[model samples]
Target: MSEAVAPRAAIIRRLSITRFRGIGNLIWRPGSGVNLILGGGDVGKTTVLDAIGLILSPVNPSTLSDTDYFGRDIESGFEIEAVIALPVDSAISAQVRPAWPWAWDGKDAVVPALDGDSGEPVYRLKVRGTEDLELIYEVLQPDGSTGNLPVMLRRSIGLVRLSGDDRNDRDLRLVQGSALDRLLSDKGLRSRLASELAEAEVKDALGDAAKKALADLDNTFSERSLPVGLDLSITGGQGASIASLVGLTADRNGIPLPLASWGAGTRRLAALAIAEQRQGDRPVTIVDEVERGLEPYRQHALVEKLQDSGAQVFVTTHSPDAIAAASKASLWYVDYTGQIGPLDTNKVARHRANDPNAFLARVTIVAEGLTEVGFASILLRRALGAPLSQFGVHISNGGGHEYTLELLEALNSGGLSFGGFADDENGKHPTRWKALEDVLGPLLFRWPKGCLEENVFGATPEGKLEALMADTLGDRTGMRRQTLALRLGLDAKTFPELATAAGDRLRPTMLDAALGTVPAGREEDKGAYKSHGGTWFKSLSGGRELAGKVFTLGLWPSLKPQLLPFCNSVRSAVGLPSIEDLPQ
Candidate 1:
């Protein structure tokens, strides 16, 4: 038969804060997984977590007297605002308010102040003239009317008062007395079985019986029952016969023998077992400096056990081993500001994955955008003849300049190369370039002229070499060039319209006019195109003919052998160099 299952518990979803002590009224959304609140000793980290617990649980009168809650004495009260996620079955939203000590009457409970318009009851408690404690009940109905209090709400309030306590020790005792005792006590086990049997609605009788039977088996294994007259000596000089049941034997003199008479580690394990047995089903468990009082190996075991128990665990530590036992996402470094933010998991993971001696070996690459990286990778590969990915290139979209800067700073701190292109759409601002260069240092690189010119054929020399193929293959293979030309006002048609007309002919040009590359043309054609100041081809070479500059200095001399064939073919068509060995 299948075993009985326990109901899943709901977790606290959101924490809202307003005018709390030390904190300047802020709402923080904690992550779902294990949240590590990290900050310097007095940065209100513990205060935040305590406030969350307070909101979820009933208000303790001791909190009213707590110095931190109220600025000074308990009389000079302060306000606290918070909201908590409750189980769907529990029809109550968490709320709290201060109550004067002298506002409660003996027999009747005084209703706290209510919002007249909304009719929502605001929580407040007061001691009456006779010093009698009054339990005020206010009912806010969905129809915007103040109505009679629900019986369930009043009962729940009673439960809250009975269940809540100021001291952690008292709270632990209450938990142990209630659910823990019922789950772990032998008498309580029988009571559970009897209750299950009495409830006819519990259909799976055999399965229920099996659960009871298993509980009995667990009880046997859990406790040590000593046989009469066989005294056993526990480790640390505690004498008990139960130790013999677990393989501890007495010496020849009939004196009880110590279990640690076996091993010190075993004795420590026994103490841990006793502690776990004492702490039963508590909703939340706080383990401060859990790694204390244990060897490194034992500390690891304790962490594993605690994590496997499915309890909400909070641990504080300065040990690297403790941090290692926890996942990278769970490790948080406490900052001076008291704001618990995420740690750099990427760096931590890299360090763990690659045990590098020097911190510089942990560097990472961060880029501005995918396109900038796309072009940069092509350019660098063409210039260096090596794969850019070998350097660990990463791209971050320029959503905002601040985010790019933050990422760069983080990577640079880890000794990584960080650089990428930023758009010059804002007129090539010096401040923006300087800001990035300041963060990235020597790793930063950008185009000399601030922007790539309209026509761009390819990222590399090879791609640019292929771009010349457009002359033979027709303009069909150069869409990027044509599109860029149209955008920069060098082409007559718009990109979309041009693409419709020329198809794949819109290839990018390798030659950057901003880099002093001029279009080749006839001397007469160049004269017509020459600048008369601030005109098209004229301003390119100080009003000189475009053809003269192209022939004299624009084309690189190293390309002479390769360009001869293309120059001859193009010259024959346009009445310049013929399709023959002209230069070569």
Candidate 2:
């Protein structure tokens, strides 16, 4: 028989939060891969993750305690609101509103106003001193209206609140128990027996032995079908049984193993395995300080594992290694203002200059935001007719100045060339311009003659060439002003403008120019002209014409013999196919 396939876990498709403590309402679309939430402590990173859990699984009134894990009085009232992605069969779209039960004068009395529906049947719990909590549980009807809330939420709020901390609790065991465990328990058997008894119209047709046999059969079937084993072991003196699922297990040294007992990396690996096993079918897995308590090597392993798990993993870390391990697209930097924005990979590359590994190669363009990177790449590819990846470009979504600097340093150290692009920000200070020049040298190109930031796609193609030539040739003697000007079709006066216009376009053109290939032509004024009875040499005197032609008649013949080999070398360094087959 074919092996049974495990059911695919439900992914978190959407997370919406409204007015949960410090955070004003916000929605996040976490990627399927590890979503690293980089931020300082107390920036609502954990709160946002907790809100997700609370929305799906609210704390039960019976489970509430005066002194909770954080040691704060378990206030009788708290509000949590969120919309989670539910399984396809889930009655609700996974919307949840959980709150502490309200009591007035030590008597249980339902709040009358809470009984009224805003649109659908709204469940409300009014805790006297706290904000009124309302849960709108509705299902999409065939006629486009909302149906009733799920019976599970009405019966027990704990069904929605899958508390991470409560997973180890015994009374809370009902919530954390695996499907197999639920199938083995007396409760599950009793429920099954009750259903059968009701169906057969018999009070106790199924005896205890029959129930036990059914439970055993279910457990055996479940165990046979699972990809991994689950074992429970009681730790001596703690009165707590630790469950080992998947391939994880405590070392032979025993519980409370010494820090030195296992390799430094083992803890991170163990934690990662535990997280993956516990994640199950849940959508979001929030890990606090993923980089904390992990050594550098272990951190990389953890990042790889998280990425491989294909779950939405949110991690906060101060470690550069953790940031480096995260893909440029996956990284987010939390600012001092508590706003989380993506990191510019280029900026990150520049920030950690001392560490070579901090910089990433493979042409991943890092931009400050998703829109900028998306639009810019579209514009560049449309204008250039070449894949941006061909040029080793990556766009990083950076939060601010600090992130920008970090990216630049990281990239610079990694021996990658990157151009920084940012918004004009109401046309105030040129932030991107300053960032590029400070790290890469001076601003070689600016848009509209240093007015707006340089239009990266529109900049002349020769700038990258010029920068390369300047760096490689090391002197103006071989790359003479007049000769170079002729190659680029510019007089000395227009040379600066042309050079500034080159931008990234310069690199490829420089390679070609160095190999004795003529540069493309553009139109410019030949001489003074008169229009409609105007004087000669008028401002618009010059008619449309070729600005300048790259003089190759004698140039190629003179330079090819000496420059061909060098051109081939430059091409190889940049990972481009050789130009040896092309005509000199």
Candidate 3:
């Protein structure tokens, strides 16, 4: 006979939840690998994972309360159902159990008489909570038949949860349904160990006084007409049993201590390590905030390891390190309305590598570079009365002009909520840029004529440009106008004549210098136009300072018309008050 092939692990192919907690209704088709859930706070990310755990949980008599209902309306009652793909030779499948015969072709369902005719043999498990706080767990057959899901079959599914705020190391203990107990189940180890503990010879270790105390207890038991006599043994009363007391411990020096004595991070890691060793079962592990007690490096490692574990995994994280570390995963985004959808990995690859934080927000502003990000952030803060985080808005640094446009296209293709900010580059790359303009419409904001430097300086009225230059020069005591002009490759000999030129006569010259019109000296060229040797306000901090100074010099009103609309668009997307709506 051919060698018998081992069965595969069970996986949840689809999850449907209704009237549960904050989620009114949601149907999620998660990938077979890792599913990384992300969204703003209270968006029902946790509830989705909790639904999966509750429906297929091995624990008997799961708890239910009125609060578990959506909007606390128990009249509708909550229901969580899942279509699970069972392993070959699975006991719950019709081939093994015969009663529940269901199959799915990844979309439609059918009841087949033979297992080979089934596209994908699946079992539908559902849990419903009633008005009186009662829970009913059942299996739905393809033939319109229903039956109670046996606890043994549920245990075979083996769903493990490492929940957030669960720092007590409960999973590491030998509790009724703990990972350790499951790992050691069907071995009769607990009974044998308990019997040996009861037979322990304590008299040899105790002193005469202690021995006499035990003898008096035995004599009192005999006088009470009890056939059994009491002696020194492990305490088993007051709801304390040997199974509850027995747990894994580590030794340090000469003393043994419970795993709970370790730090939270170590304890959780140890528990998960044991969970991974579950015999004959490949568990679906769900972790909430995997970065909770782990450092950056460990967080990355945890996600990568879980991905390679070959069993389906679901994890929720707000950490950028954890998000980026999930290089291969199904990125699911949940909005404030409890709608869940997958974020295409190809569409979000650039951001996952460079700006993973954007994936965690409800809406993002894809800024051309550090300058645009800083400039937009200052304007948003002034308009929104708070930081961008307060409104679930994130500013992603798109690194450059072309890169920003690419990110915008990706975001648009992925159907994500985003706004864009970039310089017109004096109309460079007009085709691609105009296409983006048409796609984004009002959500796109670009400078009209030139780069950031040229726009601000070019718009400044005559004498104000001179005043702005003086303000920018700050309090450098010996820094003369002549020296500055000389550094810009202007005629060093005619500095006096140029300084006294009429109107903002020097404004255009300064803008030219900023744009690299005059250049020669290697030292001067090293720091010039664009981000290199000559441009002012090129770096992130430099741009922020320039924006602050622009406001301080009362120049914001001049630039407000061109910038305000974009700020308001971002504000509107995040449900914040617009700039025009804010108190003047």
Candidate 4:
């Protein structure tokens, strides 16, 4: 058998925050693997990550201002607390082993009472900011005492935060609490460099001309009535060290290039690469807007790497590629009220596989297929006076008929507001439709009698049937007609006569061809009429064109009775006015 794998380190069991920026009160229990946060703009996704970083920041002096408080009300300062589970043999565990009283059984915090029974040791770390802008970071112990969370202990937790902006290359330098500093701490690089630089050998390394220039500079300073003489040493002035002055660089063609010279995306990847090189350290990585400045392929690859890195990761993203790449990550949905709900991955698997971007919107319209998605998106855009995204609404392809109902059920269970649009499928699965109807009410729209092809064909007026037929078959009418004639076993000369024969004969054949219900017996005969473009208006682009043509042909006024209520319900859901309330 293979050896047992070690438990992931720096796992945050639970997080609680109050009076933080843009978040009044919020609690989140992220998974040990990857916790992918998805939601609309200004939903506090970044604030959640900020709270995590602040509570565990190794920096002694964290920036705090009135704006950090919720609504700029500094009277009630913010508090962020988390119960972090540490590895038993980790350095941080050894430092806090004396006060480790709490235990985590993967769910709740437990206190061991049995004799010789000690559960997984955990710590309750908290950070509080007072009204005076003073911050306190401590660990609440079980013995009615609190201890200051020292910088050394916080650094052992290995919290690395990568923001979305361009100015995030601090980790590439040897600054205090930076990734490079931590990596070179045990090597005594600072003291060694300081000693070497202070010696006369370093000054000798300069050429004779440089040494003469330095001597002249010192003489010039003395002549100007200055009492100090300049020297090339490691120390600059007061409060300076070698670590603060040194940084990492990449060698290209025998030339050194600073990491800051790279693009934002390259710098982010380099920082993560350095963080990953730290032996025996599992960093709790928090990446905000994981898709910033990266192409789709890079974003997908980066997401996959983060998920399997064996370190607890938190990410916020608006890209579908990132969401799709993180198949094993837990999805968390944050609402407008700062309430976060963790979606069940099993239930949302279908939606994630089909249209992962739907989760990024506050309200999703689950359409039956691409046809319905295209039609609904355009119609809603025209009705809403802007794009649906302007109102936090997105129309998503539900994959198919049965999957549409499944996705709606899952969305309902996940406490996500959604609207549904699909065909009646000849009234199949009435129970499923009825169940969604009870919950969704007017937000759900389904055809009364048949599929999309049947309803549109049945609604077309007889006078407009010729234009509708021409639009349906697309260009190359002669070839399309000959193909239809061959499928129906008729002469080419009589094909036009048979195709537009009359009101009774014409529509039935067209509906059969569009719906792929021709030649009732033979399996190969099904969809035979459309095999050579007999009825081509069944695809996404075809549906969009059909919707535009239907409006231009003055058929929307008649079809509005079946479609208006759902549109108005969507408008109400996203805080838009109903059609009746809009100015005519």
RMSD of each: 23.5, 21.3, 6.4, 6.3
Model 1 misplaced regions, further than 4 Å: 1-7, 18-21, 56-63, 70-282, 351-584
TM-scores, all candidates, are 0.34, 0.37, 0.76, 0.74
Which lDDT value does model 3 have at 473? Answer: 35
The residue-by-residue lDDT of candidate 3 on 382-435, one tens digit each, is: 777887788887888988888788777766653444678888876888888787
- Model 3 residue pairs with clashes: 526-533, 527-533, 527-534, 528-533, 528-534, 529-534
lDDT of 2: 0.39
lDDT of 4 at 308: 79
Native-to-model Cα distance after best TM-score fit, residue 571 in candidate 4, in Å: 4.7
lDDT accuracy of residue 498 in candidate 1: 44
Give candidate 3 misplaced runs (Cα > 4 Å). 1-7, 65-67, 94-118, 187-242, 320-327, 332-351, 360-363, 389-393, 424-459, 470-534, 553-579, 582-584
Compute the lDDT of residue 376 as modeled in candidate 1.
Answer: 39
Ranking by lDDT: 4, 3, 2, 1
User: Candidate 4: worst 10 consecutive residues by lDDT?
Assistant: 1-10
- Per-residue lDDT of model 2, residues 1-584, tens digit only: 12222214333434554445555545555554566665444455666666554443432222333222122322433444332223333323354632222111111122223443212121222111132233334433323344444434432221222123312222222222322232233444434543444455232455778656656766886878853232222222322222211122345746744322354345444434433443333334555565655678877877776676655566666567877776633655432223444554554544443342222322233344333444344433432336654543334444443464455545444333444434444444467556555544311122223211122212333433333223221334344333445545565434465556554444444333333333334223212111211110001111000000101122233333333443343234335555543242
How many clashes (backbone atoms < 3 Å, residues ≥3 apart in a chain or on different chains) does model 2 have?
55
**Candidate 4 accuracy as lDDT:** 0.76
Q: Identify the superior model by lDDT, candidate 1 or candidate 3.
A: 3
lDDT of 1 by residue, 153-204 (tens): 3222211111111122221221322222322444444345444545553334
